[model samples]
Target: MICSHVTVPVMIHLKLHELPAKHVLKRWTRDARDIIPPEYLRYQKDHGPLKYSSR
Candidate 1:
């Protein structure tokens, strides 16, 4: 008996116009959480914002 490897191509259909507003908001919020460290965000949240000194 002989065995062969088979590769399959995937086809995807996306209709952006058909998507709802809530789905966009859900995806945006999910992506936003990982942009920065939680501790840095906590410091900003508690102490207003970071002050940068330019040299």
Candidate 2:
């Protein structure tokens, strides 16, 4: 994750088992886009699937 204009260096990284599901991700995406400005967001790039948790 790279952002030139950042408040916090990062958000806490969640483990794969802790990640949100598709429906929740969809809703969060919608809500975040609604509140967060376009400039702050910038471009997005998926890094492929997360490392799977053995747990």
Candidate 3:
């Protein structure tokens, strides 16, 4: 997805398959808003913010 923010560069070659692992791993090292897809975020709205958790 494209990052409009000045700090983060636009991700041009992103893949959909990559998302599942990131979600399972709960990638704390990266920015959630930047990495995760908007559609997934919208679908998961009931689950609260996509933050890393022990549980």
For residues 1-55, write the lDDT of model 2, one tens digit per residue. Answer: 3342441333343323333353254436645555656554444343354455697
TM-score, each model? 0.20, 0.18, 0.20
Give me the runs in candidate 3 sitting further than 4 Å from their true place. Answer: 1-26, 43-55
Ten contiguous residues with the weakest lDDT in model 1: 2-11
Model 3 / residue 48 / CA error / Å: 10
Clashes of each: 0, 0, 0
The TM-score between candidate 1 and the true structure equals 0.20
Taking all chains together, the TM-score of candidate 2 against the true structure is 0.18
The better-scoring model by TM-score among 2 and 3 is: 3
Reference-based lDDT, each prediction:
0.44, 0.43, 0.48
Across 1-55, the per-residue lDDT of candidate 1 in tens digits comes to: 1111311111113323333454345335646555756656755444566666898
lDDT winner, 2 or 3: 3
Considering lDDT, where higher is better, how would the candidates rank from best to worst? 3, 1, 2
